[model samples]
Target: VRNNGGGHANHSFFWKVMSPNGGGEPEGALREAIENAFGSFEEFKKQFSEAALGRFGSGWAWLVVSNGNLEILSTPNQDSPLSQGKTPILGIDVWEHAYYLLRQNRRAEYVEAFFNVINWEQVAKNLEDASS
Candidate 1:
C-alpha cells in the first residue's frame, strides 16, 4: 500500500516539476527565499544533489517546505515527505529505473543531470502555494 501510493504520488510530482526546456536558476522571490533557506542556490543544489546520491537502493530525495523554510531530505523505499506533513516542492527519484538507462550505475551523474531538467518555475510556484 505504501509503496504503490508513494511511488505514484512522487512520480506525479516529479513529472510536473521537470521539462526539457528547464535549467538555469530561478528568479525573483523564489530565488531570494532559497538563498535565505540554504545560503545560496548553488549550496542548495549541492545539498539536494548530495542527498539524492546518499540514498541507497531504491528511494527518493526531496526539497520540502516546512514552517516557511526549505529542507533537503531522503527517504528509503517509497516513503513520502507528505507522511510527515511537510510539503515537497521538488524531488528526484534515485531509483534505478529513473537513471539506469542513461546513467547506468553512476548515481552521481544522474543526480547532476536532474538539475538540468528541473522546472524552476514550477518549483517556485509550488513553494508559493505551500507557503500560503
Candidate 2:
C-alpha cells in the first residue's frame, strides 16, 4: 500500500496546492516562515527548484515541516514524508510522467512553470495545519 497510498495522497495534495488564479509570492505568516527558513522567496524558489531537479528518478520534491522546522527534501518513487513523520507544506512531482507531455524530459521547464500556478493560500493553510 505504500506506493498506491502515497501516490494517492501525494497527488491529491499536489492538486490542492495549485490554482488557476495562483502564482505570486506568499504573504503573512507563511511568507515570514519561508523567509526565515530560506533567506528570501527567491532563494526559496532557487533551493526548492534545485531539490526538485536533483531527484534522479520518479519522485517528489517537498517543502516539509519536520520537528517544527521547515525543510527541503526529496522522496524517491511514490514515497511520502508522512512515513518519516514530516508534514508536507508544499511539493512538486518530479516524476517524468508529471511533465513529459509538455516538457518532454525538460523537468526544469515544468518545475519553473509550476511556480506560476502555486496556490500559496492553500500552502499557508497547510503550514497552519501542520503547525497546529
Candidate 3:
C-alpha cells in the first residue's frame, strides 16, 4: 500500500520539480537557505550528487526541509522523507528506468544532468510552504 502510494506521490513531485527551461542558480530566500545549509550551491550540488551516486541501488536523493532547516537525504526503494516527518523540497530518482536509456551505467552523468533541468522557482515555493 505504502509503496504504491509513495511511488505515485514521488513521481508527481518529481515531474513538477523539473522543466526544460530550468537550471542555473536560485535567487532570493531560496538561494540564501541553500548557501546557509550547504555553504554554497556548488557544494550542495556536489553533496547531493554524491548522495545520488552513492545510493546502493534503486533509490532517490532529496533536499528536504526538517525542523525549519534544509537537509540532503537518500532513501532506498520507494520510501519518502515524509515518512520521517521531513518535507521534500527537491528530489531525484536514481532508478535505472530513470536513466538507463540515456546514461547507460554512468549514474554520475545522469545525476549531473539533473541540475540542467531543476525547477528552482518551484523548489523555492516548496521551501516556503515547508517553512510555513
Candidate 4:
C-alpha cells in the first residue's frame, strides 16, 4: 500500500510540477533558498543530476525542504520523501519507464530535458506552502 500510494503521489506531483512554458531560473524566495543551499542554480542542477544518476536503479531524485532547508535525495522505486517527514518541492522520475521511450538508454538526456519543463512558480508555491 505504501509503495502504491507513493507511486501515485510521485507521478501526480511530477505532472503538476512541470509545464510546457516552464524552464528558467526560479524567482523570489525559492531562488534564494536554492542558492542558499546550493551556492548557485547551476550547482544545484549538477547535484540534482548527480543524485539521479547515483540512485543505482529505478527510482526518483528529489529536491525537498528539510527542516526549513532544501535538500536533494534519491529514493528507490516509488518511495517518497513524505514518508521521511520531508516536503518534496521538485523531483525527477529516473525510472526507465519514465523516459526510455524518448531518450532510450541516455538517462542524462532525459535529465537535461527535464530542466526545460520545470514549473518554477509551482515550486515557489510549494516552498511557501511547506514553510508555512
Point out the worst 10-residue segment of candidate 4 by lDDT: 1-10
Write down the TM-score of every candidate.
0.97, 0.98, 0.98, 0.98
Give candidate 3's error at residue 9 in angstroms: 0.6
Query: Clashes in each model (backbone N, CA, C under 3 Å)?
Result: 0, 0, 0, 0
- Mind giving the per-residue lDDT tens digits that candidate 2 earns over 12-81? 9999999999999999999999999999999999999999999998999999999998999999999999
| Model 3: per-residue Cα lDDT over 6-95, one tens digit each | 899999999999999999999999999999999999999999999999999898999999999999999998899999999999999998
Q: Tell me the spans in candidate 3 whose CA falls farther than 4 Å from its real position.
A: none
Candidate 3 whole-model C-alpha lDDT, 0 to 1: 0.95
Worst 10 residues of 3 by lDDT: 1-10
Per-residue alpha-carbon lDDT of candidate 4 for residues 52-112, written as tens digits (9 for 90 to 100): 9888889999999999999999999999999899999998999999999988999998999
Off by over 4 Å in 2: none
**What lDDT would candidate 2 get against the real structure?**
0.96
Q: Residue 105, candidate 1: how far off, in angstroms?
A: 0.2
Candidate 1, poorest ten consecutive residues by summed lDDT = 109-118
* lDDT, model 4, position 126: 93
| Model 2: number of backbone collisions | 0
